[model samples]
Target chain A: MNTLVLTRNDLSVIVQAFGRDALMDEVLAQLRIALREYDPSRTQSLRRQGFVYEKPRLGVLEWMPVMRVSRQVVIKVVAYNPGNPDDVGLPTIVSTISVYDPATGHLVALLDGILLTALRTGAASAVATQILARPGSSIVGIIGCGAQAVTQLHALSRVMQIQEVLFFDTDPSAVASFPRRTAFLGLSMKSAPPNVVARASDVLCTATSVEVGKGPVFEDSDLKPWIHVNAVGSDLPGKIEVPLSLLKRSLVCPDFLEQALIEGESQQLDASEVGPSLSDLVKRQQDFEAYRSRPTVFDSTGYALEDMVATEIVLKHARALGLGRELAIENILADPRNPYGPLDVQASRPAQDRALP
Target chain B: MNTLVLTRNDLSVIVQAFGRDALMDEVLAQLRIALREYDPSRTQSLRRQGFVYEKPRLGVLEWMPVMRVSRQVVIKVVAYNPGNPDDVGLPTIVSTISVYDPATGHLVALLDGILLTALRTGAASAVATQILARPGSSIVGIIGCGAQAVTQLHALSRVMQIQEVLFFDTDPSAVASFPRRTAFLGLSMKSAPPNVVARASDVLCTATSVEVGKGPVFEDSDLKPWIHVNAVGSDLPGKIEVPLSLLKRSLVCPDFLEQALIEGESQQLDASEVGPSLSDLVKRQQDFEAYRSRPTVFDSTGYALEDMVATEIVLKHARALGLGRELAIENILADPRNPYGPLDVQASRPAQDRALP
Candidate 1:
């Protein structure tokens, strides 16, 4: 009943308490295991419908269900309405996660998924990099410098010996200071043009949501063999960040094939070209050596189950440190003695009187 | 910048301040306006593949995306794994809501959808009944007296004149005390058989989450030709209470057809038998009149846009009455005054250490 409400500071506390590297390292571990728990047969794709009375003539709703067996968590998130990115001055997508105790079905914790989303997305890229990238790939190119960009560097640093970072944003000045932060991480950073970063960096990460529906970011000519590409930007219908020709030529692997086909860069490519899931990689993992020889595409449109995994990790860490503010948002019936009756609210009279009578 | 965290007590303050009737009226108004803003061309299901990671061989991740309009809010709620009912003695679904300020692309509020889900769900049912139910019809028959049943009555009391309510729950004792709470609304209550209550009441509501796979509760033969059966439980796959035969016989109108088809009692019958959407009732303006002559079915499967409406209402009222608690659960950059690049925790080490360490 005492659910801890972790503040933004708590997340920062955890980041500082456990080095960011250690956090991303653990996050990837948990996510990898979470991926293992996915059983296509057991999962459910929920339905949604709403009333639409105007132009465009459609009301919408969505339901997604996921399970992380190793972590013992199941996650579902519904993003409803034709939420516009321009209207909110933020990502159109809004999310929240419910962490439950699988052993007892007890509702455990509820956390903000926006940050979790940015973290897990970056962590997923780091995960793919850990499995596919050359071990000492110290130089990295981050094509987008938005919210997920910061986390990408944070998570990647946790897994690889990230000695240098190259940053690019449409507004070059927006990310001119990337080098300053890397200095604290004991790494140097530079501002580079798209080609310079893509051509010189050992690993490439695309984290732009704006790239959706425009065109591919890189052509086959831009990518280097053995250099891994982590595409985390576009994750919706008609969204693709990497060109089909580039994807076809690369040793492609996706977080989930069904997903990549619908949202990832693979959405545009022939189904045969998109490659297998991380599960496939785990199964035929012996070919890990082959990753070094081929140009690799790590298409990561984030997974919601990762939020649950990250939530469990956050809860576990928060509980261990005894961090978080506890507040009761759900009204617990005052008269627990009357199990079948309504919750009493007489105390609310004072507020009403102060405002009205 | 200030998000008030409204606890159950706060919710009580909310109701007391606005008065239950006022709240119901406001919710209905909001629901109508919400329906007016939906646009189908703007919404394609949020890509589910990206968020779900099927367990290695067992489960999958689910996140649904539903969009409304250009100026309105679109939301995604993650209702992770539902707790096992018997083992946990709790509702299986736990969820949260996120409201986006699309103009600035900023995530404005991360809310407790668990609370809003129940509130909005009950509010939505009341809207349906207010517009669809017969005039002056008060006495009610509730098929299953679960958690939603209590809210069902509370919501109806605000919209209709009722003097009595009869409930039928598997656990007889569960409904034994059901009548007392509604006593304040000038109503008496009791436990009665489906046939008995179905015959006596002018308006009947079936609220059991249990369905046909489990077995039907009442046949079409049990319904009074004049009764309005508000089916609120058959909203998920594998959950149905009203028999398909009842659906065939009645003038059925659904909150959302696509949803009811897969989750409602309509699922038991072929898709052909399910009637038009509730909007169609609004469209043709005939459903309300036709129902007066025969048993009417308001197939109520919850919708996300309604949640958006409810959230918008609760939040508007919550802010006006100073309810909700502020949560500092979002990200905090090191330099709050002038944040740049990835957060440098080291730069803010002094501040954090001063606070804790």
Candidate 2:
């Protein structure tokens, strides 16, 4: 059987054709449905397994695998190289998602996970913001105007009436380019310092690439009492982006608690201080109504379930538009017992002519 | 950047051109070198992580990732479906190997892992047999003549001067087709019962797909005193091919100790009863010479290092022969900070034309 291969261009075509707002809306809706109907016994999502190395310029390669029982398995292999942007002019994260047939273990599709990852992460934050942020929350504050900041703005715009964006970044070029990169959104944008952005908005997103052990992008003093924070950049140990003092008092909900405790902003707080998961909030919105009136934090470490939902939406659109290449990557043998059946043995020379090296 | 995609057809072309014996010989040699020079600090090979489900079918999908410090990362995603052979007309295991550039987290190559897995597994057994099997061994016996049996015989033939082969399988068709499938080897072959095959051999291989709870393909009664058996089929907990009684009296060397304790044949024995790992045996051959004169078992659980070596060999040959397709799978953006730069925005409709559903 042939596996459908979707390149980055194909994914871009999907975004251009379907429109980012519609796509993120579908992702948000599907994520809510997936969370609402999720049964832990049926859907198995594990913490990522990978290697972190310092020699090859401080990077990590991880594999996130999630299985929907009797359905399909989605595995996303992602690499995070902190120095890629300056050293090699590449994004900090590069990834690919592979989907497999559960019954026969056949690879069904392979898609570019770079854009998918950013899109899904944005949708995850939107899911949390819609549930926790106050109604009619319009002003959005963004720290770290990098690649992730655009999607964070776009996704929140889809869920909230994001009319004005106040942003800050350590890099002057990223700060200058933010308005141009997000010009299509047509929202009034302003470049400001961290503390200025922190105190002026009702919903804030921290997506900075702050150096390890030097975080808490802004202090907890000059913030709105009812502002909701989406802490997005603390994906590695010792790399938190939010202040601990802010998290201790707020309703800190993590996307995946087991993973967030190790990598997300929740790492700074004790397990007992952390509130319910995003899924828990989605399942019982009425139970968490009290947290909307207070400061809240959504610590997102990125879960495999988000990738699964994102991949499903991408594949659905790709298949409908007929926008991928189908390649016979695996050897589907006529006789399952003979692996050698696929060899082009006619081209082989005699055994006597070939000797061991 | 482009990723070199090697399909099963491409891999078959490599095997057909390089010759199976020569390829197996090179794999065996490289495996020896890799094991001898292995340092846990530099090469981080983790235990596999995935899911096993028994829903529509009984199957497992696992990702095995290994990273060589300052070098590349190799991940092999494999699926094991016990009902594949009879129910779906596919191999019991299907897999794909992806090689990533550690410096930038760029995927350099994607290769079909069906034949690669079988070849590397056989090479792993040969590495152990060459060190622990008797010198100048001629008679070879094989139990459970399935897909893995062919490679086991081929790899052993590369290390020993085999003149005759005695094989047995509960499946009559597998027993009847064994000789024809391995006709190119030109060795005399006979089909016999499991006990008869076990009693008349200097080296033996057990590659069966026995049920999880129903195992011990052959009893320990009529075996030769100095026979060395490569147990290649016991890869899951409580799924052993060799008898526990036999393992207790013999020196059992596992490919990976920690993994074997959970999934390999070494699970039948206590921690102290098991011998050193295969790498340990390669690193200190002199220390294990005494076991060559007695009954010994090589518990093969299949490690990621083996897959890494196998992938390197295949990529080297593929590069030299120009046998695989190079596709631009990932977006190498000019501006590292703009993920949306690749979108065909000119083709997109106006915002008012596309609204959220």
Number of the top TM-score candidate: 2
Candidate 1: where are CA atoms >4 Å away?
A29-65, A69-107, A112-115, A134-139, A151-167, A188-190, A282-284, A334-357, B1-3, B28-97, B104-107, B110-139, B158-164, B268-272, B282-290, B332-357
lDDT tens digits, residues B63-144, model 2? 8889888888999888888778777788888888889988887888888888788889989998899999988778998998
lDDT by residue (tens digit), candidate 1, B1-357: 323455556666766667655565566667665555445565322322223332321122233344444444445443323222333344433444556432322345545555455566666677667666777787888887755676677667667777788878776645664555444344577787877877777788887746337757776664566777778876446667776676777777777767677766667666676666665555555546756657677888667666777677777877887667777554434322111225455543221221111
TM-score of model 2 (CA atoms): 0.97
Per candidate, native contacts kept equal 0.16, 0.53
Q: All candidates' lDDT scores?
A: 0.60, 0.86
Q: Is the docking of candidate 1 incorrect, acceptable, medium or high quality?
A: acceptable
TM-scores, all candidates, are 0.80, 0.97
**DockQ per candidate:** 0.23, 0.57
